[model samples]
Target: MDRVFSFQASGVCINTQHHLDALCVYFSDRDQLDSLEFYSDLEASLKSAVLLPDCVVMIASRKFCEDIKEYWSNDVLKASFVTRGERSGKPFIKYYYLYCWETSGLVEVFSHCADADVKPCFNLSICDLVQQGLYHLVKENNVVQIAPVGHLFKHPSGTRNNIFIQARELAKTEPELCFVGRSISLAFGFERFAKLSVVYIDSMGIYHFVQEALSFCKVDARIHSFHSYDEMRKLTPPPIEHLIVISASTSGGMARDLRNDQGFSDSRILTLIDKSDSDRSGKVLIALESVDKNIFDFEADNFETEIELVGEHFSSKAKPPRAVTLGRPHTPPKLLKFLKEFGRDGLNSLNEIIDGQPKVLSLVTEKVSRNKVFLKWLEEEVSWNITVAIDTVICTDDLGSIEIANTVADLISTHKVGSARPTVCVYRNVDWSSVSNATGVLVVTAVARDGGLLREISRDLRENLNSEINCPRHYLTAVGLPQSKETWSRLKQFLERNASERLYGFSEWLVLPIGSDRQSNHWSDLAALAKTSQVVEVESSVVSKSVVDASLDLVSDAIRKGFNGFLPKTDGSDLALSSGFIYFGDVFKDDLESALHATSYLAIASALQKARDIDDVANQLRSTGYESVILSPECFLRFNDNILHACILRGCRKGELDYSSSPHHSKLMGEFLLKVFSRHQLPYGAAAVEFAAALATQRLKLKKNDQERLVGKVVNSLKDEPSALLGLLLMVDLPRVSMLSIK
Candidate 1:
């Protein structure tokens, strides 16, 4: 065997060149320096030194020597030497160390023989050394004979502390092991070896630190950490062959229990007790079935020495078994059934799935509003705590849509009594911008003339609303309400032709005659349908008075029941009715102006009655002699009718209320008109007289035959107002009397 030697330089400071020179002299040949590998970077020759063919030499630091002694002791020998170097450019002496080993033990064992006898010794091998007990081969061609520089026969502290080394040795044959402790140091030592499957059990609190330390060291091992024994028990144990119990005190019972109860019966158990404990023994004796085992104290021994012993023992044992696989246990049938019934497939089964999993049923049916079946089911099967049902109604007409929307909105707002059973939301037209992105049921009502419009709305909802709504069980429904049979037929054809392709592309569409006698039945069906639906959508024409009224009635009923209410469109039919009044007034002029005045007066009276303060203000004004200021019925009707007509015209031209102009002015004008109309009523004769005067005024602008025809109609309307008709005829002849001057 080829002999190798290692030298460790230890001092405050040492010179590389001087050490090399001294080494050359000691070896008696300058070429022997070629075998040295130096640790310093100062000398190029030393830095680049290569090993000799026969012997290998290395110069390293004391720390490196200690490390080598710990791990590679079987392959290396260590010793120390003192040398001289320059301190501040003067001569200084320092201690240098060395570690050496024989590459081939045969040559060293037979070195006393001459060159001629060297060939005979070539037949000798490492097996012969092991039998002689003069040397031991840790592995093939690796011999360890020399005692390390600081080898301990017994712990100086009188405690047998060699568990780390013993544990490491055991690990070589049993790579799968369990460690029961909170000692970070033990984990650090254990992580150094690769291909280890280690289960580390500690109190829950320190598991984080252990994981952090392992991460810091970049440990590559199969490691499972648990905070409690129960947590550890939950895991399928790897094929454990060793158990290391590290504790602050000697607890042999823990080790024995882990070995017997944790399916680690075949595993070897090792205990390492901390030295600081009062009951700790120098060498703990554990009672086993077959023998008394000795547990070691780990604090009294040097960590590196222990490591060396373990490394030697590891090299001597057979390779560890392959890692054990940990797999998930089979799930119970009951749990599997519950998961299957509560998952995506179950939702399609609808109410049937709610039979067994009542908790899941609660999640779907809780707070359901307007859906009677769901509410009734909840009341009977679940809890009466299901207090409110929310219904969403949408009006989808372009004409008079806002008025219907406002009416529905107002009804919903006012109908909310304390804790009503159901609440409702009426969206005039679907304002995609205002829709919430929250996950829930959405009911959409779309009223469109053609299937193309319905399809467009559906596409918009899909693009803007569907993906944004995160609720898994949500549904979308569209309802079409047509006024007449012709319209209903046209709508039905459009829906049938394009529903699947367009309307049903996103949701289901239903067509119903809203103004028909079955309106209540349709709503009742809808309420029941809502129970099964996550979202409910009803599409109806805003212009359909029956549809609007029916939607409002449903919302009102819900509110009256004291349910939670949400109405986005919260104004009465004032806008629509007022607009209608204006339309009729413009067409009929003075002839129907009295009727429009009566409607406006009634609206004001209704508003006053609802708002007591406003009513009181009106009462106070009447009591202050304001009634004396009231104008005659004809003049009052003409003046306010002109204001109403102008306001309507402004709204028609601009498509919105001009609060700063006509509408605002009309409001103030209405207050005055209300005061007059409240105090007096226009009789049929006065209305007819006003109509005749208005016709007479228009006759002045017509041709000869047109004037005669207009006079005939005025005479017929004023049969009981001959005096008023004569006054109108007189006024018609006055070329200077302008119609505008009448007001």
Candidate 2:
């Protein structure tokens, strides 16, 4: 296996040296979209794009953010660069670049990443530095300014830092970035922009004080934030230009706080709030850069009203509003609850109960003390609902009691859901279980037999039920215990009927008992006339008849049910889910998303649960058509009543894990599945054959030297069939990297 488990095999890498000498960042003057047919507009850019093979930077746009957000459900992968280069007299360097896209192309235009607000160039305000390329690396006081267009003059900007600014003229270009009164600047205390003349103090007092403040200022300083809802409610809509409003304090609203004045709107709000609190009361929302925005939308519209409703609803739901925000899980309450609830369990393991159950249903006779025996008075037995009632019978007859128990057992049998399940009987060694159909008919009845005839049939039945099915089935025994001779006769007849139903008249089969409950250890005493329960055998080689044809008829009816369940009879207009969803994901393809897969499987289960006249849960399961090849551990744990935690372990032969452990077809499947894993960001420990295969596909990308280490780690985590695993490992060698076709 190249690698299988994500957590285990994740750390191998090949350290390759520098491939390119200079970085070649390709930036287009237009926005480019990422699409499925083409990786990006950069695909063509990559061809003639890389004049510098050592470094490559492909420009991105807002669309890059949109497409990735829509399509990526698992994890967002930061981009990587693959380079193969050689320096003269130096060994070749082969590596890939991996980093943030935030500060790449625009920054690379000049020595420093260009600020979006500073167009053309940051030093463009001065005409001399506009048309030139200059690099200055000078000391703090010994200053100099050399422009490509003019004579050397004293540098007007004076500072020892990376850039200097002597702002005494201070009033030349009007400051587009400004803050106003009582709407204090969240950072550096107050708005210091010298051109900032008009100011509004606070949004809370704005309704009462705005006109007075506006009368005093030479220029109308635009109002930024609106704090009180009542204040904003009273103000007339401002001119429909972009404007800012600190609608609420950090102590109040979510979008209120503005940590900085960089928002790009021509006018936008910089709301103040306490920086320490993590909730809405603590965070700030500031315009990165002000742009033209409809001034009426925020000032007098219902925007904040809607936001407040959602926030209140979110709080009520014990959830956070996720549309425009991220709220953390309720960790504090959960942690405290965990500690308080489990301290006792952690400190004491011995107080728990543990016991083992038996495997077969057989009868044995043993001596018992008088006090230990359970004696019942013949006449004083109370009228009780504890025992079932049907057809006006108290089940005093042996066959009738058997029929009643058998009805419940058969009900359970039909509940198979799909496959055979274990059945247990604690009293007798002859425990066994049988398949249930829609219903259980009386297999045999003492009402149908007379004397010794019923006993003979039961004798034969008791033999077959014990040896087959390995399940220690339920036993309804009657031995030395008190019972009327009529009940005894009925019991024998019940056994005879069941024996006949198990096999064809001319054939034989393995049999196991089917019982319902157990008391202490008195099985033989209740089921036998004497001590010799085992030695009392009937004709061993016997053939009993069955109603298989009738059973097959039921199955045929079930087929219609299954088909109806698979492809619902409703018009296509209301298809419960896709056809693929009904198929239990046998069609769960490599390209399918996990969310889609889960929804599909759940759809099938939901539909099955909705059928008409369906009462036998066990039989319905037995007849269910869909099956799963792999299950998430979570699914297994969550639906333990239904799914199996099945894992097939495979040991490696030489360096590759054996793939032969699973059915041969799984090998064919693994080959393609590996490619899917390589292409997506799948999680660790999911139980999918494709998961392991796909993980190997990813491992092949690790540095060659790290191959063994990564592969070894993954192997330790997986428990798969040897042959299946070996077959999966074989896929890693099946041309992992395709050679590009020379155009």
lDDT, candidate 1, equals 0.27
Residue 741 shift from truth in candidate 1, angstroms = 16
- Worst-scoring 10-residue span by lDDT in model 1: 171-180
TM-scores for every predicted model: 0.16, 0.16
lDDT of all predictions: 0.27, 0.24
After aligning candidate 2 to the native by TM-score, how far in Å is the CA of 174 from where it should be?
41
RMSD of each: 37.6, 35.0
Per-structure clash totals for the candidates = 36, 91
Candidate 1 lDDT by residue in tens digits, 1-743: 11122122111112221212112101111112221322221133222324211112232223234433343232222221111132363322221223221111111211111122222212222222112121111121122122222222222122333332221211111101111111232323443322234635333232343343344234444444343345534544467422333222223433444555665442333333222223332222121211113222223336322212221132212211111111111111122222222222212211122224211011122111223332233233212211123233333443233333333334433454553222223343455555434232233333332244444543454566546343221122223333323554554444334313333212323332212212232223323322312232222221133432343343434322211111111121111122333213243343432333223322222221222212233221121110111111222343244323222221111111111122333344334323322221232122222222222323112233334334433333323322322333323333422221211
